[model samples]
Target: MYSTQGIEAIATVTELRSKTSALIDQAKTIKTGIMIQKNNEPEAVLLSYDLYLKLYKQLEKSSK
Candidate 1:
């Protein structure tokens, strides 16, 4: 399971639809991820591509 320790914001599915751009900007500005929720449950994370690549690289390094 992913940790929620430092998550700075959250968006519901409906809000995601209406505020996609703002949410994405928030994620980028934070240099972290924004949790996406559905039915009051966490369902996904919105993170910048740069951050995604960074995490992917870390995963590759740790798996080796």
Candidate 2:
């Protein structure tokens, strides 16, 4: 997720299945990625599309 520290929020795989909309909103509102856990271990990150695009642009520039 942006290669940054600090998680705006966290949710388990089950929670993600049930509260996907809410979790997505939280990510958007906080403008930071949400750490998703599976088996109590961090497995993925959820980020708002805008934030993803911004980070992607930064990565592209740095790679040039």
Candidate 3:
């Protein structure tokens, strides 16, 4: 199961540009996800690539 807590570090599209690096740093430090917002509404998510790849591999193995 996944938790929304990992994906709630939101930043608007405009602010994203400036905060992107910091966001990445945060994700790296926390080993979690972040939510991106557009117009004050949730739009997308940012996840730790390492975690995503790990989960992906698990799913791939399970699907086999």
Of the candidates shown, which would achieve the greatest lDDT relative to the real structure? 1
Lowest lDDT sum, 10 consecutive residues, model 3, at 1-10
CA deviation > 4 Å runs, candidate 3: 1-8
Error of 2 at 32 (Å): 1.9
TM value for model 2 = 0.88
Please, what is the whole-model Cα lDDT of each candidate in the order they appear?
0.88, 0.87, 0.73
TM-score against truth, every candidate: 0.88, 0.88, 0.69
Instruction: State how far residue 12 of model 1 sits from its true place (Å).
Output: 0.4
Q: Output the TM-score of candidate 3.
A: 0.69
Off by more than 4 A, model 1 = 1-3
As for lDDT, the candidate ahead, 2 or 3, is 2
Model 1, 1-64: lDDT tens digits are 5567677888899999999998888889886699898998889989998999999999999999
